[model samples]
Target: MLLYSSVGKLSAATCSGVAKNITLAIVLPRYNTAYPWAWPRVGPAIDLAIKRINHDPNLLPGYSLCYVFESSEDDSGYCSDSIAPLVAIDLKFTHNPSAFIGPGCHYTCAPVGRFTSHWKVPMITAGASAYGFQEQKTTYSFLTRTGPTAKKLGEFAVHVHRFFSWTKQALMIYDDKKSDNRHCYFTTEGLFYELQKDNITLIHLPFQENAEDLDYQQLVQMIRMTGRKTTMQAGIAFLLPKRGEGGKEGKNELKKGKEEEIWRHFPRTVQTKNLTLAVVLPRYNTAYPWAWPRVGPAIDLAFEKINQDPNLLRGYILHYVFESSEDDTGNCSDSIAPLVAVDLKFAHNPSAFIGPGCDYTSAPVARFTSHWKVPLITAAASANGFYQQKTTYSFMTRTGPTQNKLGEFLIHLHQFFNWNRHALLVYVDEKIDDRPCYFVAEGVYEQLKTVNISVLDTVFQEKEGNVDFHHLLQQIKSKGRSE
Candidate 1:
């Protein structure tokens, strides 16, 4: 089913003021920003996304999909110096932006996140790809990014290293340049973190992003000095860096030409010989550990069971390319886009995608797989919404949790406690603009009603952010004393 998000408690009449037509605002970099070439491409992409969404008859029927742009004369999308004007433009009452797109740079998105988190307005970014965004989802509840995220890059590095059984890696990164270009900087940082978890030692190599002209001979010599002896047979250098020459380019961190020179120096793709399953997960997500130790072990147990019988399976060693679905919070609609990316990067090489592991993640992920065409097999996620969403979520095959079971569970709870009275205490986000949790509260209220329990009262949190449940507690006490 589509995510039934109820943004606010607006009456049919008053709602006309805020959402007469669905308008999506975009904050792109100006033509004269840090990367002039990239900004031109960002405009067309936003236009195309708007066009596709509008043409879809099933989506937003009777609602005109309009967009507003927010950018300065020569501004790059950054957090500290940028995004304030963008946020101000969006917050305007005169046809304020219903949602946001663009301002795709990591620096700009950080501040944009601050506005969205406080206001509760949904935003989708096509440009930014920082790994830190996933860790800040609770702070930026409304933001969703289509990314070349740090986690995705890290996972790709881990996959290649694991395939070759390499225990040490040279952590190559561009020198700290303009803050606007931090997306590239953080990607290598994320790659380093992922390697550390696998007990791999990473040697740091600081290079430049725009390495146009540099001494190729010194760079080559630096590689040899690091311990990895280079045999230049063709255009490609087929060796990982030697241990001692790790920081050979240390003093030469002055230019923005590291990555380009490295590619101009060493290039070739690595290939593995195993039957691979690219399992998409949120392993880099410490907020949710459901993917690794939770569903990861379950896959192992199944494989172990299969390994015991030679008659059942022969001549095949199944291994998993565990790809990380970068997440900030539990809301993983953003995570689904990266699976499409990583899948294409390997030419749809994954056997299948395993669990996203909860209702929050699987909701959006299930819908995307219809287009992604990869089989999404969920483990711990038992949302009853799955079966009804079959048409939209065609690629999904779930093996846990059901609404009927939850219905039975609620009845059992009342039976055991001998307390027939029931109610919901929903603490809404004080942001009157909109809150996504309203639908969740409605779902719980309906489910509780189905189990034949009478709801006496519904408690809402106070405007100051804390739940004022003292009165509700007193009522429960009074009811108990009377009974």
Candidate 2:
């Protein structure tokens, strides 16, 4: 939740050898769209946490805390999109961090989780509520999260449903294209099933692709088909889309126009009836834009747009803002304080550093501390290759694959599929366009080259707009045959 800074004065102990210096790597997600929401809280939280840890004499006696920061800017909403580049950057750092902190989103957590699990590093995350963390029972030793569990989400839904008194006929709308949707589905359905023990009617309206437009239309159709007089309660309505601007625009249009249109068809008296809109903040801070005023303004604008719809039912739209407080509870900070304390207790033979998240801190901090060879201890980081090779090291205390894990999988695929014999690498250019997708593609290319696999041909795709898969696929096929 909240992170605070404190200073404590203590008596000096007996003299000892040089104190070990620990480097903590905090990796932050760098999507321009999501940064506004995440950085304001996460950045300040880390800064305050580190300051508090350093000031605590008992926790880190002889050693001073060093920090490494990394950023993954892939806006595609896939964990691998950001994790791969982050891990590649971490591998380049000279310091061998003892631990790593985050790849903020569940999508980023998956790849980072796999990598840390392989390297036996401690990984801790403040967010990332994906079910896989518990369902798969990841073997990574130090994996943990400070956020609410899926079951808690179910409970919240049940309360909302009970408040509405609409036992049955609940509609659930989710973005089928994203993994986050699965989380929403399970949590909502679990709650619905439990509440329905009283014999309520629940109608599941699941939309798979083009969630913004298509799904919204499907939901309206279902509402209409249920009849205008039907007092229907809807479960979590994922108004946000996976993609950045593209998704936002689509969602905005739907909630602004189509949602109201559906309401207009209903009788005026029924329209005046209360309709609850359950908005779930699956990933904290991600819902808001990355900038300060912009973040605040964007949320305000979104709400205003939704409210402008005259058809919005009379029941208040309950926006449950589920997020970690900024206060320093010490739960997250305590996890890494001991490691720093231990390093100092051991006469600083091995330095200690602690971090809160992986994608936000580790890579950047690693880059900064590469020259010192400082070790970092993290509760979690979801970057792909943070611990690859012997140079910079990260102890992923939690579960997730590093870039190497994904690279290893690619290597196995190369061997199994024999695609390594001759391959055509298609990637977007980074120098002219510094996108996370290009960075990941390049990272994968470098890994493939390490195994004596050379790219027979390279293709650069258009940077902006929708990708023309038909032409791109044909080109890839042509190149494959030529090679």
Candidate 3:
């Protein structure tokens, strides 16, 4: 069972001569039905990592951590509504947690970053990759990430453009409403500027808003206006809008609206082998059982909806490339055998092969490997799952700092301030949802308790809307004075 306390400091219950307690908080961005993909695999991955950390003695000597999981379930109307309440709740009721992790999306990260900055708390972001969260400029102590930044993605696009020699008169499509779109635009613009320095003619077409109800007629008219003689390479950025309260309703509406507007009017040019459609999203093989059979359905469905439009019926190639694993053999020999027996309850199939890229198999794969001595490696998962393990088989080999590192940094901060007692705790209410980050916080809390740290207060906050910060601050100040 996942135990998360909203208020009151964690304490050792000395039962059966075994005393253990620590408190850590995890703040996650609340997304409505519109943003399902925002945290598709992050929540589960974080939970598994925390479970491993708490059970592993090598990670924390005697500590058993407790977690508080909170979410800001903001809808499209109010992007930061869920996160705003968390800031107030964290400031008021949460114990001075050893560390904080999350606010996964870039939108929520901005507000969380501001809140943590004031307290000098070290925040580790597993998903957010906003523009200013880098080490040099941010006031926060640390900002770690598992995903590539938009700038890196932009540079890659430019490299591809140069390699293909499609530098002359390129038409660029962008979404103006989202931060992600802004990042892509700025990054792509920078790349285009550099390409222009080499005397390459670059033509940019900026499209405001999302692809929903896109002005396909205007787009087609513009294409025709450009004339048949002047054929320019195009770079299109498709930024999806945030989902609404009615989950499936919003998606269906978006599909129907997009089909009437953009997809319907696109020119049905013959399938020119040279005209390539490059997607910036991660590329996964549809052959893998986990991804191919599961996530593939959604991708295919989305495409099917797109193809329903007359213009998109003609062949339009969509090519995608994700960061490949270090070992890209399409075989799961080293990883899948144990998972089949222990986790999935499937007999080991020698004929089964692994996919070329890593899927969301990191957490369950890591759990079976670490806790049960299975031999598997997840190349794509970025969560801190494998850190702080004694067994090589159970250890995570992916790139990124472990929760142990974040805990150690917090410990160092406590020592730096000469703070020995009177710690407070604040965490999210995990009962709301089963996100994995809650477990990571719990693991960190356990580690702090093992080291004899005393927590003064713990609080759980709502996942959305306005949070009363003034009340939380008053509580913290009162607790500090009493201590």
Which of the numbered candidates is closest to the native, going by highest lDDT? Answer: 1
Error of 3 at 92 (Å): 7.3
Off by over 4 Å in 1: 1-19, 32-58, 72-94, 172-175, 205-483
Q: What TM-score does each of the candidates earn?
A: 0.37, 0.37, 0.36
Error of 3 at 401 (Å): 51
Whole-model lDDT values for every prediction? 0.50, 0.43, 0.42
Which lDDT tens digits does candidate 2 get at residues 353-418?
Answer: 333233433443343233234444443444545655234443224343345556666777777777
| Total clashes in model 3, counting residue pairs 3 or more apart in sequence or in different chains | 32
True-vs-predicted CA distance for residue 200, candidate 3, Å: 7.0
List, residue by residue over 217-254, the lDDT tens digit for candidate 1. Answer: 76656665552322222343222221111111111111
* Model 3 regions lying over 4 Å from their true place: 1-22, 29-47, 75-82, 85-93, 132-136, 139-141, 165-175, 178-202, 206-483
Give the candidate order by descending TM-score. Answer: 1, 2, 3
- Local accuracy of candidate 3 as per-residue lDDT tens digits, 79-187: 3522333442343243556566665565555445544543456667654443344422433334556566544554565576677775464453543444331444334
Please report how far candidate 2 places residue 483 from its true position, in Å: 34
lDDT of 1 at 154: 71
